[model samples]
Structures are given as structure tokens and as C-alpha cells.
Target: MKPFTESMLNQCRKYMFNFFDYLPTKYQASARDWQVRKFVWAFKDGKCAVSAAQLVAKKIREQFGTSASDMVFVCIPASSQRKNEIRYREFSEEVARLSGAVNGYSHITVEGERLAIHESKSGKHVNDVQVINFDKEFFKDKKVLVFDDVITRGYSYARFACHLESFGASVIGGMFLAKTLFV
Candidate 1:
């Protein structure tokens, strides 16, 4: 596969930026600036993060041939329910584009009230949000590539991997379009 190009990075940035814009105006500036700086560093590094992930995944596949079971690309949900819904959908679209031509897989949304449940004392009637559901058969013996927009602390990814492993699926790889390497 060709290394990620400036155009690809720019496209990714566009999506990330759009996501940032969806945030409340008060919260968007610092987050946007932070993402820009991260993108600059990642751009200068010339696909180093993505390339490393691809290389590592390829090696693992070569060592242990891929399974017939389908893949599930997992994306973490934002704290805000509205933003989480939007990002989850956008992340699904992006995954479809990035994994083009690959068969035997589908998209699943990970979001609030289902995947990541939070309880607050203020809520006695908090509605449960049903995001997406998958049958166990679909993921059995499958290889999952968890996708996230930016991975800074990595706790989210780690928790996701652990959950998949618990389900008897192999987390063969992880792909992040961008990451915060500096401040």
C-alpha cells in the first residue's frame, strides 16, 4: 500500500476539524488548536504512525494467516451524546472508505448508554441510547481493527481491545488517523 499522502492527511484533518466544529464554541478552540498541532507533527513525520500500524498488522497476518470471520472497526464515542452520534456515523463512513474492497465485514457504532454507560445523580429518568447491535456469530473468530480519530492517552483503545478479547475475537490491529504526539 502507498504511504498516506498529504491529500489523505488533509482529508483526515478536514473530518477531524468538522468534528471539532460540532463541539460547543467555548470548547472548540483549544481542541481545534491541539488537533492542528498534532496534525502538523504527524504531517512532518510522513505517515509514520499509520505506516507503523500497517506494517505491524501485515507482519501479524503473515505470521498467522487471516481468519474467515469478519472485521469490526470500533470507534469511541464523544462525551456529548449529540457529538458522539455524529462522530460515530462519520467514523463509520471513513472506515468504509479506508477499508475499501475488503469483504466479510461491516460497521458498528460504539456510543453512550450502550457501550460506555455513565450515571449521574441528576438523572432519574435518563433514557438509554441503543446505538448498534451485533450477533455473536459475526464476530466469532474474527479480526477487529479498532479505529479512532485521535489516540492521546490510549485508555479508550485499551478498554476496547480488552472487551473484544473477552468476546473471543482477536484484535489483530489498531489504526488511528491522527494522534497527539506533543502538547
Candidate 2:
């Protein structure tokens, strides 16, 4: 894990872990790791692959241990509610269960349709496009772990962390399936 420096400095501390290296657009015949590319594509297309989620959960368990009950795990909301349901809902449940963390997947949510950040050059900030939902006291004085399929600019996790901090939550870090070429 490393400091998520893409986030604004002095925000509640945030660290991040990435399970795999990714380009997202690497399609060369000899680019290597076709499985990685396929897994990312499947996730983007709203296919929740339990095998990949299990792999991520294993890494989290190795790091945080089965005693992560104190940490609340959350995922960056999808572009819309339906996409979220199709992708992250089951993915998060399995990760949290296998990682021994509190399931906070549904705690944060999106308002409506929005352009995916990576699909655009000058994309909207994550917080601007998504409305969040959480219990007023759910995050109070708790450690939060943000989950995402990939970490590009880290804006989503960073913005979500700030929101969690606003409710007195301490962002322990983030867990991601992969990392893009840039941080």
C-alpha cells in the first residue's frame, strides 16, 4: 500500500493497494496478461466476476487479517444505480465477507446517469456527479476502506474519503483490483 497522493493533501490520511497492473486499452497480441485485460473489460461492462473479487479479497485478508471487523468497506459508486447493482453490489459483499470487514457497499450511492470519468478527457469531479447516502452515525469515528476496480486519478476515492471524513470517519485507505499506466 502507498499514500494516495492524487488526493488533496491534509485530507484524512489515505493509502491504496492495487492487485494488478493495467492499461485498460492494451490490446496488443503480445502485451501480456490477457486475463487482466479481460477481467477489467468484464467489470466495465457490468459483469461481476466472483473469481477476481475473491483474488482481491485474498490479498486484503493477507494484509488486514480476518480481524478487519472494525473497518467499513465501500466501493466507488458506478455511473448509475443499475450499473452499481450489476457490478459492485455482489463484488463488495463478497470482498467484505471474505476480507472480514464491515459491508458498507450501499452506504454511498449515485443520483442518476452521469458520464464515466475515464470515458471523457475533461470529466466531472466524482462528488459533483454522484449523490451519496450514509447513516449519520455510521461513519462516526470508524475506519473506512474505499474499494474500486481501478485507480487512475484517484479522484473518486479521494472525493469519497472527504465525504466520509465529513461525518467523522477516518479513511484508512483504498483497495483496487488494478492500476492504470498513470497514478
Candidate 3:
């Protein structure tokens, strides 16, 4: 896993952990990279996604000593109801289940509609505040590990950490499948 520590517009110095770099569409010229991107985009299929989730689960177990029984895994809410339906399951929830951690999907919810950020060509086009609604009470004093498919500007995860901390939850860290470098 790769460590991320950088400051964004709204977020100060924060750290994020990612499994791999997501090759930008423009730079995915290699067959292997393209296939990996495809697999990430098509995670709803459950085969490759499940396998990748297992790997992430292993990393979580190794890095965070909190037994699976005590850990709560939360997925950044899906961008749209349609996407949620298509995916059939939230990637983070599945990873938690396979890894033996408690699923925390009900803790974080998406309240409003917003365009899928990744669908935009540029990261600046999307606003995360309009999309995510956090349940402050649900995470009180819990050890949480937040998960997302891909992170671009780190806005969503930063806000997640902030909210969790404010509500008295100890944010273990963020885990993502891939990260897009902001240039």
C-alpha cells in the first residue's frame, strides 16, 4: 500500500492509504494498466472486486491490530441510486464482511443527488458536501476504517475523517483501491 500525505483546498495536512495508483485514462496506454482500470470500473461484477477486496482485507488486518470484531468498516456512499443498484453491493461492505470486520454502511449515508465525480474529466468539477451525509451518533467512539473505490482530490475522505473525529470516533485511517494524482 502507498501512503498519501498532502494538503488540499479545504483539507489541511492529512494522510490517506491506497493500494495502487489508478492510471489516468489519458495515460493508460499499457494493456495491463488498462485492464486494471477496467476491473476497477467494473467492480460490480463481484469476481475481480471480491478478490481485490480480500487483498485489502489482509492489509487491514495486518496494519490495524484491532481485531475484526472491534473494527467498523464504512464505505463512502455511492454517488447515485442507480449506480448503487448496478453494483449490487458496496465494495467496502463486502471487504469488511470478507475480512471479518463489522460493516458500517448504515452509519454513512448519501442524502442528496450529485453528478458522479469520476465521470467528470476534471476533479474540480465535483463537490462532495452535496453528496454525503454522515451519522454522527452511529460512529461515536467506534474505531472506523473508511473505504472508497478511488480517491482524486482527497476531499471526500478528508471530510469523512473530520466528521468521524468530531463525533468522537477514532478514525483508524482511509483505505482505497486506487488514487488519481491531481496535476
- Among these predicted structures, which one has the highest TM-score? 2
Candidate 1 per-residue lDDT over residues 38-154, each given as its tens digit: 553443343333443343345334433443124555555444455445444433443334443122223344345633322343355656665534445655676666656555445
When sorted by lDDT, best at the front, the candidate numbers are 2, 3, 1
lDDT of 1 at 90: 39
Each model's TM-score, in the order given? Answer: 0.45, 0.82, 0.75
Ranking by TM-score: 2, 3, 1
Candidate 1: where are CA atoms >4 Å away?
1-70, 101-135
> Model 2, stretches more than 4 Å misplaced?
1-7, 10-13, 26-33, 122-129
lDDT: which is higher, 1 or 2? 2
Candidate lDDT scores, in order, read 0.45, 0.74, 0.68
Q: What number of clashing residue pairs does each candidate have, in the order they appear? A: 0, 0, 0
**Clashing pairs in model 1, backbone N/Cα/C closer than 3 A:** none
Per-residue lDDT for 65 in model 3? 51
Per-residue error (Å), model 2, residue 121? 3.1
TM-score for candidate 3: 0.75
